[model samples]
Target: MHLIITDAWLARSRAIHLSGTRLLLVGVLASVFLMLMTVSVYHWLVVAGAGEGGGRLGRFVLNDEMAQRERFMRENLDAMARKVGEMQARLLQLDSLGERVSGLAGVSAIKAPPPAGQGGALIASRSLTVQELDALLRELNIAAEQRSDWMTMVESRLLDEKIRKSMVPTQLPTATGVLGSPFGWRIDPLTGRSALHTGMDFQAAQGEAIVAAAGGVVVTQEYHAEYGQMLEIDHGNGLVSRYAHASRVWVKKGDLVRRGQKIAEVGTTGRSTGPHLHFEVLVQGVPQNPEKFLVAGRDLPNTRSVATKSP
Candidate 1:
C-alpha cells in the first residue's frame, strides 16, 4: 500500500510518500480512537438516562422485572409448603394402620409419641425464607421415607402370620354338638373302668355331619377295633387330626380337605354308649391338648374345664 500527500499553501507544491507499514499504522490508530469514543458515549447515555423516556421508563421496567421474580419465588415456596403438610398427614394415617395391625397379630403395641409442645407466648411471625423452607422440607422427606419402609415390613409380616394360622386345625370337629367327655381321665363306656381318654368326644345324632377341624390332607381312612370307621387328616407343620366313630366316611386317604369341610358322620360304630364323634389333635405323632389350640384360635379366656352344649 502507498499514500501521496500534496500541499500548495505558499505558491510551492510539496509531495510526500508513505510506506505500506506507516499507512497501516495510521489506519489502526484511527479505528482505536473511534472505538473509544463510541464506548464513552454509551456510558454517558446510560448514566444520564438520555434514551429511555427521560429515565422514568427505565426505572419502571427494572422495578417491574424484580417484582415478577419475587412473585414467582413466593409461589414456589407456597407449593412446597403444601406438599410437606400433605406428607405429614399421610404419615399419621400410616401410624394408625400400623397400630391396628400390630394389635391383631398379638405383637407388642407401640405407643405413639406425645404431641409436640405448642405452648408459648403469642407473637408476630415473619414469612419463612426460601433457604429455611428448603431445609425443613428435606428433613421431613427423610422422616417420611423411613416410616414408610417400616410400615411396609410390618404389614407383610402380619399378612404372612395370618395365612399360616389359617392352615392349622383349631376349630371344633362337629358343627353343633354337646361335649360328651373331656380329653383327660374318663370311665370307659364298654369296660366301665377308669381310662385315660386321649381324645375329646362330642355327642351328636347318628349320621350327623362331621367336619374337618382345619385344612389338611386325609392320611388314613379305615375301620379300627376301638374306633370303628375312623379318618385321619395330616395338616402341615407336623399337625394331624383324627375323627373316629364315624357312621360314614366321605373322604378317602390322600384326599384334600379344607377347614369346616364335611368328612364323616357321627355314630356309635365303636365302643360307645351313644352316637358321638371322637375328635383328637396330634402334634408330631404325639397327642396334644386340643383345647389349647382351640382357645388360642378363639382368643378365649382360660377358665375351668367345662363342656360347651350347643343350643
Candidate 2:
C-alpha cells in the first residue's frame, strides 16, 4: 500500500492509493457488494410476501420490517371486520327466534319475562357477556312457564263454556207441551193447600216421548207413588236436573245420554192429572228457578198454577 499527502489534514484523513493486483481486487469486491444489494432489494420487494412496488434501494434498506408489519396489520383489520359482521348476523337470528316463540305462546308482544336471578330488564338489555346471556335465557324460560299457566287457564275457560252450553236445555222435554206450573210457591197437589213447587211442570199428552234436557250421566230412574216414574240426570259443574211423572224410564243409573236423547215416556202414572214433566234445577243441592233456564230455548210463557209438583 501507498499513502500520499495530497491535502494538509489529519494523518488518518490523508489520501491513499493502490496499484496493480490490489487495485483490481478492490474493484471486484466492490462490484460483488453492489450486485448483492440489488438482489436483496428485489427479493424484499417481490418475494418477502410484501406487495411488489417500484422503489429505490435506499428506501428498501430503511423499510424492510415495516413492509411486513403493514401487511400483517391489514390482515388483522380484515379479520376484525369479519368478526363484527358475524356478530350482527347472530343478533338478528336471535331476534327472529324470539318473535316466533312469542307467537307460539299467543303473546302479542315479545318481552322477556321477569326472573329471580340478575337485577331486572336493565341487565338483559345491557347483557353482552356469557353470564349475561345465561341470565336472558332464564328470563325466557320464565316467560314460557307463564305462558303454559295461561294456556291452562284458557283451557279451563273453554271447558266451562262447553259445560254451560250443554247444561242449558236445547228443547222442552215434550213437543206439544205447555207450562202448567212454574217453579216456586203454589198450592199443594194432594193436600189442597199452599206449597213451594221446586220445579216447572210441562203438561202434555199421555204416552208422549220425553227426552233428556242436557247431556250427562243418568243418576236416578225409579218408580214413585207421587211422581210415578222419575228420571234424574246429573250434569257436571254442580248441576242436576230432574224429570218426574214419567210413564216409562228409558235410561238407568250411570247411563250417559246426550241432550235431546230419549230418556222417558210421559203419562199419568201416579197422581191424578194429565201427562206432565216436573223439571227442576238444583245447583249444589239448592233449587234454582227452572223456568228462567228453560226459557232460554223453550221460550215458555209465564203461567200461574195453584199446584205443587214433584221432581
TM-score of every model versus the real structure:
0.62, 0.46
Kindly report which residue pairs in candidate 2 clash with one another: none
Task: List model 2 lDDT by residue over 1-311, tens digit each.
Answer: 78766544643456577878888999899999999998986776655634535435435665877888877766765565555557546644655675665464444434444447754455333214445445555755565565556556555665766666777654566665567888788888878899898888887777788887778988888888877788878888888888888878888999999877888887777774676777787888998887666656543222122223333
Separately for all candidates shown, the number of backbone clashes (residues 3 or more apart, or on different chains) is 0, 0
| Lowest lDDT block of 10, candidate 2 | 299-308
Once fitted onto the true fold, the runs of candidate 1 whose alpha carbons sit more than 4 angstroms away are 1-50, 54-69, 89-124, 129-134, 248-257, 268-274, 300-311
Clashing pairs in 1: none
Error of 1 at 279 (Å): 0.3
Query: Model 1 misses residue 173 by how many Å?
Result: 1.6
Candidate 1 residue 136 Cα shift, in angstroms, is 3.4
